[model samples]
Target: MSAIFNFQSLLTVILLLICTCAYIRSLAPSILDRNKTGLLGIFWKCARIESRLELQ
Candidate 1:
């Protein structure tokens, strides 16, 4: 029925949004660091680099 189809479409859209949000969340820290400075910035940079290295 039309309702079933609508439900399916809604589920697909919700899944896509969840995936996109997760991807963006993962990149947020690095993106925020583009204008970083001082010790906090240095710590974040170090943590980011270590994370990337660990990922491999």
Candidate 2:
């Protein structure tokens, strides 16, 4: 019973992380499309990481 409870908690955390990454990916294109500054470099790094991950 304890094992089952722990597994459920772990699964919940994994799902939450997946959702958060998907949300960030959805926002990635907008940053690249516009000529916005400040956060631009951060977004570019994320986009590069995302492309590398896709290639892998």
Candidate 3:
């Protein structure tokens, strides 16, 4: 139905945005590193913790 088509379109757009953000973050990680209080900062902290755990 039309509703299902609209939902799929919205989901695709959301996925694309997430992918673009991840790509940008990979290209310039320092940008996230400098903002230690934002959402990305939380993710960065978790990633650092995970890496540290893997090292042990």
Candidate 4:
């Protein structure tokens, strides 16, 4: 019984670590953009925005 309990606790800890790591992995890109502009740069490069800017 105690061994089972220990196994369950270990499993829970491993699962928690995996979940937290996965969450961090998911967030890492948005959190640590090497370039300050990040996705905004993509929008600026689109032709529509450029033409709209030129029109204005």
Estimated TM-score per prediction? Answer: 0.42, 0.41, 0.47, 0.42
| Clash tally for model 4 | 0
* Candidate 1 lDDT over residue span 1-56, tens digit each: 45337988777765555454445436785553553587545444544555565569
lDDT string for model 4 (27-55, tens) is 56444234345664442233223344456
Model 1: CA > 4 A from native: 1-5, 29-56
**Model 4 TM-score (2 dp):** 0.42
Model 4 misplaced regions, further than 4 Å: 1-5, 29-56
- Between candidates 2 and 3, which one is better according to TM-score? 3
In the predicted model 1, the residue pairs found to clash are none
RMSD of each candidate relative to the true structure: 11.0, 7.3, 6.9, 16.8
Clashing residue pairs found in predicted model 3: none
The models' CA-based lDDT, in order, is 0.55, 0.57, 0.61, 0.47
**How high is the lDDT of residue 22 in model 4?**
41
lDDT of 4: 0.47
lDDT of 3: 0.61
lDDT top scorer: 3
Please tell me which predicted candidate would have the highest TM-score against the true structure: 3
